[model samples]
Target: MSTDTSSEQRIQLRLGSEAATEELARKLASALDEGCVVGLSGRLGAGKTVFCRGLAEGRGVDPREVSSPSFVYLQSYEGDSGPFHHADLYRLGSMDDAAIEEAIDGTGLQHVLGAAGLAAVEWWEFYRGPVPQKLVTVEIAVENPEYRSIELKFAGQGLQRALDAVS
Candidate 1:
């Protein structure tokens, strides 16, 4: 996997295989704090799950327990700074008002923000845009047989600190 510099200054990481992506995720997990919403974008086989594995591990979660919750739609891991919520919004049946209200409300945004240091959302189109202004977005793109590109963009304070940690 290879990378290219983006005009937006987003750090692009090329992950060459699932393991590599997972490692990158782990690195990212270590830099997280409360109230962080990580927006993930990628296609199937884009290493989203592998990346998340690293994230869980970085958060001090047992990597053995990490799995894509595409079926259950959401999974929680505790052991890191705080609970880590891995949410897969791909299966939301509807994008209407009620569906979102149900999913986000029941999940309790405040509770999540307060308790979950990092919230990683896979297939983030489900967000319906207008993510919190403080969100940090990461876009993944496959570059080659073993390479995946990770681009990070931020919208709040402490971005440089996060970048320094990631770098």
Candidate 2:
């Protein structure tokens, strides 16, 4: 697990519906611009992608374009705000040194952090390597359509806006 919680700030949220989950996504996306990365983790059927749909909608992109990149690896969506990079690292296993290098050096995933308005990584905790130092990691735990828990962890900051949105 590459999730270094030492410097990260976390907030827990209770979602009453799908809209609530998306609302949280939108609020977080609104706070991010260039040089930002967001990580997401949860169980199967945890509404991770569904939350991404909300984030894409919040960023003014077609929500349908926010599907998981498990197959393609990376999915980019452009909107009036900017580009949204949705990446699924679940299948890739550990992000080796080369992968981490890509994540920071513009030639790889890090390019998304430097350029995209929002970079949402799913199954992020599963990746064994350095996560983007400054990131907003969202963990979704769902019980049903109207009952869910969402935890927002800022890699090195607080998420007041996101908390206010879901509260």
The most accurate candidate by lDDT is 2
What Cα-based lDDT does every candidate model obtain?
A: 0.69, 0.71
Question: Compared with the true structure, what per-residue lDDT tens digits does model 1 show for residues 1-167?
Answer: 22322222367666667787777777777876676777777887777777777778888888888777877667887864777878777765356867775776665543454244677777776665345535667788888878878887766654555666666
Q: Which regions of candidate 2 are displaced past 4 Å?
A: 1-7, 93-107, 157-167
Instruction: State each model's C-alpha RMSD to the native.
Output: 4.9, 5.5
TM-score of 2: 0.77
Error of 2 at 16 (Å): 1.9
Clashing pairs in 1: 1-147, 15-148, 16-146, 26-54
lDDT of 2 at 58: 75
What lDDT does candidate 2 reach at residue 122?
Answer: 84
